[model samples]
Target: MKRALEKLGCAPVLEAADGIAAQEVLCRHADVALVLTDITMPRMDGLELLRWGREAVPGAVWIVLSGVETFDSAVAAIRLGAFDFLPKSPHSEELAVAVRNALERRQLLAERERLYLELQRKVHELEQTSEALRRDLQRAEVIQRALLPHSPPPMEGYCIQAVYRPGQHVGGDLYDVVRLGERHLAFYLADATGHGVTSAMLSVLFKQRLVLVDATSGLPLSPAAVLDAVNRSICEAHAAPGLFLTAVFGLLDTSNASLTVASAGHPPVLHLRAGRETRLVRRTGPALGLAHDAQYHEEHLQIAAGDRILLYTDGLVPSGTERDLHRLQQVLAEQRSSVQDILAQLHDAAQGAERDDVTVLLLDAHAGASWFDNGAEGRAAAASRAPRTEQDVVFYGEADEAAWLALRGRATWMQSDVFHETGQAVLAAQRPLVLDLSACEFMDSTCLGTVHELVARGGVTLVGVAPGVHALFEELSMGDVLATVRRDAPAAPELYAIGAGSSQAAVQQRILQAHEALSSLSTRNREEFRDVVESLRGDQQAGGGHG
Candidate 1:
């Protein structure tokens, strides 16, 4: 048997006296491809051997040989998973052919097992790689959101709203609405050449280098000068080649209601007035970083009260048509709601099919004098227009020494005027302010800004806060900005310290709190608030302040 097996290319053919010994032989050789055994043996027979081999070495093939050619024994051997069966005393040619067929079948099974294992290993590696990429994208999204403004500047008679949606986890669209002073309002919108991590990084660097005011004189820079400085910064940097930026820089003067804008290869800014008329301010020069010395020109418009301006990136409208501006303006004019409501309408109209980063900034000019100069009159006007129910009136009268203010309905831009007045009054009185917000169903950016401003003055606690309002504060990470006690909770003891001693230290603490809030807001907020805090500190140092 061994000699015949060797002739069929079975090198070093192994032999055993019985089935038990043959099982030991197979155990010693893991690479054994085929097995040939007789049906009847000493202790363990071929049928038992076949059953054990079928369970232990599933990828190997087996063939049986028996001199007792009984139909029952042959059927049992075949059922025990033998590849082929033949008589024990057979021709050498037949034995060689059977061994060849068994070896070929074994080789195919081994190859299939190897391929399946390799596939499983590769799938595991891909899952690990995908998990790592997902974490990276989440970190990038957090960084991008941190770069945006926390809340609009607390300026009077000018309402600003912004919406940003990146096509990926992070994108290249950026916008800022900052107040340079009491009279000058500055805003800028920029879009890089592409989206995702590369473009998002470029936008962050651009935001850091784009100077809004002269460092030495503290004067607001011109729209053209701002763009020129940004252009030079982009051109001189070590950015990727073929990358460029399109932007519109604008300044609004509250004194004359004039707006001066400078554009660099960006789409035109949309101007919509109360009468439903639309106008477009076209681009003045090529995109930034494309040229070493790109000169930009400025366009001036005599903006009226109630005039609306829309500044956006290219993704807000289609690239092919100029009439998209008109359509957008018509949509804007049709909505008489707040800025956030208008943005919701526009977002739904798009059906979230934005392929690039979309950024939109809407500014509405309110017809009123600055709250800094006419706080009492503004308070009266706001109070007259505010719709009050019996519950609101009762909530307002809950004050002993603390000033109680109840907010009702949606706290949107329309409520901002009253909020500013209420904030100023509470600050000037130097009393504890207890705010009742249980009746307020919603809040917008302007209302949130007002809340921040009021809390910055110290000695403020919120009572009767609804769950939605509480969750909003938590979402913005401003839960610790002020104390909020639910209606069921016991009243806080600090609410009774309106005209108490240690008022001087409390005022100083409030100033410190304001500084902390400013630090938490954004980089621009920290920079702008620096001067205000310093001025207040300077007055205190000179003994001309209440503290």
Candidate 2:
């Protein structure tokens, strides 16, 4: 058998006397690939050796041979994991075939085991790499969060609040409210184009370059000029296609409640008047990094008592639709509690909808207080001040007939309930109600929503709508009601005051009803105001009103 295996080029074939001797050879030569054994050998049989060899030298293949082979012996040898079973004294050609087959089987098994070990090593390496990446991301997330403001700066006669929620461990939304000088406050909200490490790095660059003062002149830049500078910096630093950011910057003159705001492809700044209609300070320039010389425009307006300016990233409203903006406006108008509560509500809404990185900054002007003094004495004096008796609405006719209601000065939520009560009474009595806005300088969201409710019903007319008031209507997408507007109306007479005093419950109900009326105008309005309406309903039930 050894001579025949050698002829088949099986080199250095070692001979064993019996199964026990074969075991000794296999134990010594751990690299042995093939074993030929006689089933009936002394000390230990081929089957026993085959079983022991399988456990000791698992890679070796076995071939059993016997001159007087019994069917049972051949079966035992084959069942013991022998590669081949052949009779003793067979032809050299037959033996060569068996040895060749056994060696080939051993080679295949060794190669398979080698590949498996290699695969296991690769899997371990991948797991380590994945864990390293996870740790890096966690560290990045902490750094990014640290860059955000912990709280807004304290300002006299004003309340500032902010909320930032990143969609991922790292996000691209950033906001800051910094005091530019003794009398000026600068606030901004910026959003990079995407969400990830790259976008986050770009947002960091934006923060670093958001210079409020001119480097050369050492003078504070205007809101528009600041945006222009930011845009130029980004355009120069990052010329990559599809990379950009939207931002809104505002500079406030703390002394006179004047606000100058500019936007670069960002969401409109929400101007929420306490108890009045909300207005949008629209965007005025292209997105930053889009053009090297993009010019931005600024809008200047005087902030009033109980007024708030809301700046947010697009992540707050992922859809970026007219309806979505209206919804946010409605939320601001409805949530007249504290700035913190408003931010919480907005953040919850954004999170519930699974939005991207969301950031909201609110600036509120305190009512009836001096910007220079927000001390306890000032607050006590403000609390002790008499309620305003200046009539904002004057009725000229009876409720049973055509009634003329002249809205004087700024018709806001403080007086919206009075007008709302009179308008409803007149409308309910099947009488004609005419609203005179010729003397009205401004009408807030509450009053506008009240007017919307009255107009939605029949027998209402609006005359002498001022350009600003007309623009408000257009912005709310209530242009259809503008069809009832006339160039002029007859002079009103016998004016009677619609008093603006009401219980807390009545005021809450009025605000709720006004927003409900606005919500009924369109499907989008309904969706946007749905939560506000439900919340109002709960508040009304709980005897709770805006703080």
Candidate 3:
């Protein structure tokens, strides 16, 4: 039998005298693929060997053979997990077919086992990766929460409230209420273009770059100017197509309850008065980062006692319909209780599953505040205490020596005369000009352009530059020039005054020169100020002045 099997290409077949011997041989040769055995054996029967071998070599295939084949014996052998049972001394062709079929079965079982183990390994690896991603998202959500305000700053006779709810682990809505100097309170709400980590990152950049106070001036910027500056910055550095933000910024003068608001493609702000009609502060410009030269217009309103202003993201009204907005307005108008209660009512009113981030900021004026009445008498009282405008420009040191030019108060187009006269005088003397902006509260685009012109002429240094101003310069692509400038302490000496009072033609000339200088700084500046420069030139020619 062994010779026959070897002749059929089954090599190195081990022979055993009985089932017991077969067990011993099988134990020693664990790598055996197929087992051919007889139904009757000496020490142990084939059925017993088959059962024992099944456990020892689970992957091996078994076939039974007997000299006197019986139906009962064949059934017993087959029940014990044998692949085939045949009479002993069978045809050579039948023996070959049985052995071949059994070996093929063995190969299939081995492959099945391999694939099962591999599937388990891959599933385990996927589970580990999923767990790590979950942990990372948790950390990111914590950091995003930290960027939000824990509590609003205290203001007399006013109540400020904010609520933020992200639909996912992290969201794209951001809001901040910052106190600018002593009198102005600035607040804004921004919503990025999309959801998830990318949008969250964009919102963070907006928060970092939003300049509430002017760097050159120590005072707060107007709402429109604040939005315009932020838009210009986003357009210059981070403008990706289809990526923009909707925002509304407001500046509140606490002394007289005057609120100036500006919006960029944002939902209208709801103004709820105590007993009058609810008003909407609507958008004045396109969304941020859409256009470099987009202009924002300001809307000024008086906040009376017991009035409330609600600023929210579109998530608060996902439907974005007139009925939904009216419902929100009705809720704000009816809910005269605490801001928290109003927010809860608003949330309850929101229908369907939340698909976006929801953010709401509420400003409430307390009842019976005498200062809330923004009448002419109140304005007169506030004006009486307002600081008088000081000399904006003063020059120190003689023309021959290195000179210092100080800018105080608000520097705008009105100060172009002083800037032109002093700048020309310093250039004629061939002296290095050091500009002092320590006491300056604000600088308009015209003034910034004039400063740019002086820098272009060479030998110019800017000192006491505030962080906001530095960011502005960098956004306008003036960082290379500013990088070489040095900071130095101003010297106290005789001050020479240059009045801003000048002819219309001279003022037009200064505006043109300043814008032209700014336009030369960057391509974006050139595109932005091109119209203003051309318009001024046209005006100059019409007035018979040199263009």
Candidate 4:
């Protein structure tokens, strides 16, 4: 039967040929487009041959030759990704058309493969670039972390807990507890204007200048003075375009009982007392880097034991509307119910997720407890001496010899820095050190405020204060400018009556209630009553008590 077909010029069908041989021939020869094979084979069948040929040969076409015209065979050929199936009695033109169509389809598919490979190559290149950029960003983050202080500086009589989170990989928020000397603890939290790494750069710039001012001025610069000087320097440095800083700078005297704070365009600082009440402190100056003379307010906070001072950037408020911000303050207050409670609140607030660059600094005014922060042992020592406020020092822009001499004469106890190691050395000596201002001319209000805080918080006395520094003091008053100054500085020259000014009459009444509560308390609840009284007194005095 096969010979008869062969005599009619038909090729002898090798029905038992294995799929491997069929595949090899299809791949090896460029001209072999049509696949002619029997359904049943020794090793592999005709359907397997068709599928293999279709994949291996870019433009290969398949035609199955079957002895039986069964539906199952036809279905199997299609299932194997095979081309057209033919019976033994198929017409010539039909065969020709099927073969032509398959060849055309394979050609179209070959072009598609080429385009896909090209697309894959481009995609790989894009992925490589993205990876490189990610690496670069990671490197930048490392450098930024290196620049920040490893641990919060130590103070003699205070416990400070601060949580700083950058909104992005690098944020503009900057906080550092600088030890100007043994007695002075200078800590500042600064938030640059706007967002992104540009703001962070400004923060970096402010820190560098702050350190520079401490070194060169040789003065016991207060928090206000530092803010003023830093603000001016930043303004001058970035005055070219739009740049500013909303910041808070504090100078604490752990040995004494005063905290001097200065604010520049930051949010109103909160003073949380034990009475389950909170007060907003509006200090002045201006944000750093705004303008050369942008004013900042300074306030004194008297602290004893069991009191807290909360310092934060504006991200906590989300715009001061409603009580969202105040709620955060309340949360802070209740958390102090215990350490465990505080930790829980902190964990929830910052489960490593920050809405913005939310930063919080809590100063435990009650000097008994010690704080382990940022790898540093933070302690605030309570001086067993009388209170003292800011002394006098001339503002210097550039270094000068004559001004330096005047500062030396004016201030017996000079302070430079107390938060960092170098600042610690400059400020620690118990002597009435004279600060050098020969290299400084322009001064920032934060430095002035810091000096004030030291005087109020520590036992250092504020003597021979220059009138020039007074203007900055008056400008940052929330109300009762004189009252604020006096209360902030324990070493104030003269004491004023509690209700001296008519403007503060109501304020004095409330204040008297608090003070009387403290002064008239009996021995039984002295500690408990004293805590509330001291806190209330501090709140009312905003000007008198030193930390």
Highest TM-score against the true fold, candidate: 1
Estimate, for each residue in 245-351, the C-alpha lDDT of model 2 and write its tens digit.
99999999998989999999998899887676777888899989999989999998788988878888877777779988887777777645544455556555556
Question: How well does candidate 3 score on lDDT at residue 273?
Answer: 85
lDDT of 4 by residue, 305-420 (tens): 77787777766555665465566566768744533344346433654444566566777765555432321111011111234333433221101111011232232212222111
Question: Against the true structure, what is each candidate's TM-score?
Answer: 0.63, 0.62, 0.62, 0.50
Candidate 2 segments whose C-alpha is farther than 4 A from its true place: 66-70, 73-80, 87-101, 337-355, 367-547
Better of 1 and 3 by TM-score: 1
> How well does candidate 3 score on lDDT at residue 324?
76
Output the number of the lDDT-best candidate. 3
Query: Which should have the higher TM-score, number 1 or number 4?
Result: 1
Best-to-worst TM-score order: 1, 3, 2, 4
Give RMSD to native, each candidate: 17.7, 27.2, 24.1, 27.6
- The digit string of per-residue lDDT tens for model 1 on 264-361 reads 99888878866756778999888988887899999998788788888878776745275666666767776565444545565446645546777777
Residue 463 accuracy (lDDT) in model 1: 75
Ranking by lDDT: 3, 2, 1, 4
TM-score head-to-head 3 vs 4, winner: 3
How far does residue 206 in candidate 1 sit from its true spot (Å)? 1.9
Displacement of residue 504 (Cα, Å) in model 1 is: 54
lDDT of 1: 0.70
Error of 1 at 437 (Å): 24
Compared with the true structure, the alpha-carbon lDDT of candidate 2 equals: 0.75
